[model samples]
Target: MFVIDCPTHGSRVLLSERRIRALRNTDTGVLLALECYCGHVEKISTGRRAPARHVPE
Candidate 1:
């Protein structure tokens, strides 16, 4: 269970799998398809990645 912000319902609690519409893996994080009790659906990504640095020879 996690907390997600829903536009229609303000901050909402994701009770269980019931709130998960879909999920997939991303290069940097997991893409989450979340649904609020108000039926609002949104996508969120988990994890963070720093920008790649380029080195000049």
Candidate 2:
């Protein structure tokens, strides 16, 4: 499962594996194609080379 900021849900949602549409390998990381409960599909990356997060200190 993975969490993404879903526009329909108006918050981050933990998507289940059943909603996953596809997966791909990239130089940066793993590409994940996931579907939100509202039927919105989004692709996100994960792994060591993925984009860095700018969290508030």
Candidate 3:
């Protein structure tokens, strides 16, 4: 769970896993595509983790 300042909501909004549309790993952190209860889509990054490495077959 994470909190985001939604422009439409005008305050911190709680985002659950169910609200997540997609997740992507970046150099800095994880990018999350979330949809708010009011149908607003926003992207937020949280925490830093190493990016995944691909193993060639």
Q: Give me the candidate number with maximum TM-score.
A: 2
TM-score: the better of candidates 1 and 2: 2
CA RMSD, predictions in order: 9.2, 2.4, 10.5
Residue pairs in candidate 1 whose N, alpha carbon or C atoms collide under 3 angstroms: none
TM-score of each: 0.64, 0.76, 0.65
The model with the greatest lDDT is 2
Native-to-model Cα distance after best TM-score fit, residue 45 in candidate 1, in Å: 0.3
* Weakest 10 consecutive residues of candidate 3 by summed lDDT: 48-57
Clashing pairs in 3: none
Tens digit per residue, CA lDDT, model 2, 1-57: 777788888888887899999899989998889999899998878879999765322
> Where is model 1 more than 4 Å wrong at Cα?
48-57
What overall lDDT goes with each candidate model? 0.69, 0.84, 0.77
Q: What residue pairs are clashing in model 2?
A: none
Q: Write the per-residue lDDT of candidate 3 for residues 2-43, one digit (tens) a residue.
A: 666678997768888899998988788888889988888887
Candidate 1 lDDT, 2-54, residue by residue in tens: 56766686555555677889888768777778787788877777656523434
RMSD of 3: 10.5
Ranking by TM-score: 2, 3, 1
